[model samples]
Target: MKDTKILKIHNKSDKPDNIVIRDNNLIEECIIIEKSLPNFMKDYFVYLKGSVSVSTRHAYLKDIKFFCNYLVESQELTIAKEICDITLEEFNLIKARDVNLFLGDYCTRYYKHTSQDTTLIYENNNRALARKKSSLSTLFKFMFRNEQLDSNITDGFNPIKLPKPQPDAIKRLDIDEVAKMLDSVENGYGLTDKEKVYWRKTKLRDKAILALFVTYGLRLNELRELNISSFNFSRGEFKIYRKRGKEVLMPINHTCEVVVKDYIYNERTKSELLAEEHKDALFLSLQNKRITPKAIRQLVKKYTSISMETSRDSGYSPHKLRATAATSLIQNGFSIYDVQNLLDHDNVTTTQLYAAHKKHVKRDIVNNFEWIDDKKETSLD
Candidate 1:
């Protein structure tokens, strides 16, 4: 006898009737998982789909899968062998202690597939554990609010307290370092003869990229997503899509405007690598496609490293460029509120961190102490 295949069908109303079938095995696996989920859990994910980004939803799914695996491996719950096998009643039966074990111990020893090979190995880190805890916490809160679970067991689990990140006092470039970086990119300084030749080809584009980072404090994604239409030459402004789906208009400084225009007209337009579809892109790779975030980071690192004296000074990424912009603005007497607006920070507190790191603040404090000491010494003399 032939085995019956379980097929998962999407609600026809939710999608177009003319569906092109592709990747049969992947479709089958998705169908199996969909069929396996309890109705309540399915509803929970459906509710989340309306609110969260695709990447965020993907994390939630992974975290929930890990929780289900814990039930089977640690608790020896036969019903939890498959995620769909776990019932709404079983979820309610989960105590605070069960959740604590999952968040603390299970997360610490979970297997991760290595990038170079298929071998799975245990990896434990505070960041990964904290993310899982947060994911589970979000899930439990959703379940409790929707009455899928009798109580929120995750509420009883203590927060994962990771150590504070060390301040990047040494990592941030001073004003002279920033000037040197821009000068090197423009003049091909510290570059080999071969590199200097390549730098001439990409100088305008590279300068525009660096200028945008220093001037606007754009996140990597925000910069990568830029199109030619994103800039308004007449209005002297540009639009950027920020985190959480925000679109904001930002003013372009005179330096950024000139460099970007020069690249667009002189270098970018002359490139034979530009593809038809990517013509709208503000930046293109050698392949003539929209430049990726990874490529942008590499470019930033390349120029930053050339400006540094040692490897210790060479770890600056695009984010550090963002920090540089914010700190520079704060040091030049821009209000924290203005810096927050420019950085597109939702909260003022985030901008305050940059303000706290202002080099001028430290300098002024030291100078005041010196003045006090000088007064005492003069009085004694």
Candidate 2:
């Protein structure tokens, strides 16, 4: 079966959320043709007709483009003249064998390069390459449907088995390391007395952001989209409008709640925030506009750099904070099922990446499973 993730349009109906999968038997597989080609291609049309959000569409575009660049460079196919040069017929011809060969060769040639340097795979994985791949994939699919062929060549072809370079294992901060990092933030690159005061207030907001992500596993986008009114204090739940524009209420623990309360009551109020007519953005920059993703990233990087210096190897990224929260929750005896629900992952497998074996903790706790002799039998008398 083709393992596909379907996008659902958010409907604010009273009915409960339902997902509709559209792979394999979902559609009566057939091949058709048209006089004229599609604007993009067949694969892309499927995605567009489905409920994919803008960001998701953009990401798919990027991934496809990266693949396209590889095709162009490796095959020596000059497709820049007209986008149509990469037709469905052409795409199907490029098989899994080709993809596997390309990935193996690419990784072998250029794997360990640092961020400062450029390599073939690195260069092809940029935003532009993503768009190219997206457009190209759709074109291929369109041709399979419309272009006259013996059969559905696209379907006959095997799925690409690209190399997924294993990411660094999940690294989380202990309570002491988290505290030390927070303490060190007051001393950053350059701070005058005025800057120090400014940093103090900013630090509170930064700490709150990190604390929430670490404690709650909120995504960077989810946290950025939050408003002062997003939280219901009485219920201890914050409403998050997720990527697909679905509303989800995230329950918070006391620590995260405290940090949020402190940020709003003490720091955010004093930032001289100015909102545009439609701008109900929760997080604001010093200039008072809604904080951009880049700004948030920079803020995370700065704190992460400071945190790394204090001995935590993974540093303080928003994502690292999210991973930390997931790992920590699992280590504290939370089930993978509970973690999946809390993290709001659509798939259990996404949650399982963090749902790992607790080998280190088990070694320490295994002995304690047997009751102490003094405590075991005294109640019998």
Candidate 3:
């Protein structure tokens, strides 16, 4: 782990004690990739490490690897055998047409991965292709900015146009379904005898997790990163770290507050199951450690499948709970701007997409229209 001392203090509360500045695992992963790639690419990763999030850097590395594979297969470039051998002159030979071909071909072909003599073939969708193209564009821009390349070949190529948003694309549960899901969690309606026995032990924690998701529209990572100190009982609020490292405080409702408090004080404190390292974490797995995002997702799927009939069609996940929370707020007469703030969206356009999904607004508008009197009115023929 790397440590940098704080030279300037803007606010005392802003800098928490023992705060992790960078993920050590991510730094180690970047170092491994740096040793494998060419010097220029290594430098590019170093530049990106300072500016972007760990997740973004990880994705860029994967995309660049895909680009290298494309160069080997399509262009018959020997440098692909060892990425470190690729010269600047070879990089400059890549044109906009080559990039176009890469994007087009990626969508149609299968990317094969082999490990332990087992092969897996993955197909790229339009969105995946667009993301790969964006990653390549960022790499080219970096090369041009640093004078490593004479010009950016990716600049002339047109980007892939995404399809317009559809109403059905946003899958969310109705208010009644949300109520049923909560009830099922509390009552253990459809669970097996063995599952019910397990639920009896962790019901409070499970309820708290579900309440937080439906009430605040928390993303999986946001929920997972929560600590016991994050909640302010006096203020009736809790703090969360959002994407891009932005921290925001959100008010807790009566129901969420009750469940979370019950889990923390009644169940969590009494249990001696927690690992010492995860003592400060708000939610814990059966293994007595901080819960993973995958576990939280599976929890949501398990409960929703038992509680809602439309779970098969709508698909229940943590994100779907977020959408349900947004839709419920809109249905309850909150403004789109309010929903945007609650959900922590960077743009109002994303909130507007939820507004488009509100079928009641369209129904009310159509219901208010007066029909012409067929007996009294005549055509102006």
Candidate 4:
């Protein structure tokens, strides 16, 4: 007879916010990927877990996993037969030039066979290549710091030059467009009768969602992770978990207060309306589940597309709505530094990009400050 102890399942509502739970799930994913990697790479995983944001750590681990797979799969370049079998000695043999070719040639374009008759081609731009490089760099640097590497091979790795973001390339809705989007959310303007049916039931909820996005300029995940307790109406503020595990308090304005109150009191279904686990979630789907990022994106697109007078498919994401908020605030004479703090940007230069948005600036300046008399100039011509 074989005897084994029963594993106890302890899943329950213990965490204060869903963001912490989501972050822990991401960390678990990193650990799962790390388990598939070689033993020597475990230190790097621990280092990342301690030092980096959950998303960044996940990306780094994924990149490392891809690289390890590449090392084993590329028969001509590596002696190792599998990723798990890749030893520290085998990894130490990897030269800077080998990595350069892998990033520059292999990562730029690749094909993955899905089935006997199907294949998927993947391409990485300079930004993606740079990220992969940064991942490798961090790994090597960490190992080198601990004397696990023969030398800091990252020094020899060729630098990937990335294109600088230009102000003219920024996409955001102007002030009038912002007003139009809000109006559409409130009144269900331009929605097909079919969409309007759903919109009518969720109008207050939708309005609250859009209002918070535009007012707070929240990242998709940050807003998605909101809990009912995160808001303190009497205090006129809400708490949000930011990147790298920062908890920031954001002041709630009158408009946001009204819309959120309207949704919670009038439209938001609670208790049996939820899937038991998502009882504390701020936004909800028709299926009584916490709203997913994709759903939020689609709603943003629906209203923004109406505002832009574009096709439904041409609608913007929550991020574009974030850009709209930044530009609108800046255009209305708010300090860029203040906007930077509000947006939780690490650099003021990022806020400067929003400040540099020149929507109608050229024409407005010319129209308001015409130095030459148009009639005289026309007669001379």
What range of 10 consecutive residues in model 4 has the weakest lDDT sum? Answer: 5-14
Q: Which stretches of candidate 2 lie over 4 Å from their true place?
A: 1-43, 63-80, 84-168, 182-197, 269-273, 277-279, 304-314, 349-357, 367-381
Assess candidate 4 and give its lDDT: 0.86
In the range 64-169, model 4's lDDT, one tens digit per residue, is: 9999899888865557787888888877777899889999999999999999999999999999999999999999889889888888888889988988888877
On lDDT, the leading prediction is: 4
Candidate with more favorable, higher TM-score: 1 or 4:
4
Over all chains combined, what TM-score does candidate 1 have? 0.81
The parts of candidate 1 lying over 4 Å away from their true place are: 1-39, 70-75, 78-80, 112-124, 165-170, 269-274, 359-381
Using all chains and alpha carbons, the TM-scores for the candidates as numbered come to 0.81, 0.65, 0.86, 0.91
> lDDT (CA) for every model shown?
0.75, 0.58, 0.78, 0.86
Cα lDDT tens digits, model 3, 48-118, are 88888877887888788767766766655445566666777888778888788778876447756577787
In lDDT terms, how accurate is model 2? 0.58
42-117 in candidate 1: lDDT tens per residue? Answer: 7777775677754466666667776776776664544666666777777788887877777677667767557767
Model 3 spans > 4 angstroms off: 1-22, 73-75, 111-118, 269-273, 310-315, 365-381
Worst lDDT run of 10 residues, candidate 2, spans 28-37
Cα misplacement distance, residue 85 of candidate 4 (Å): 0.4
* Residue 181's lDDT in candidate 2: 55
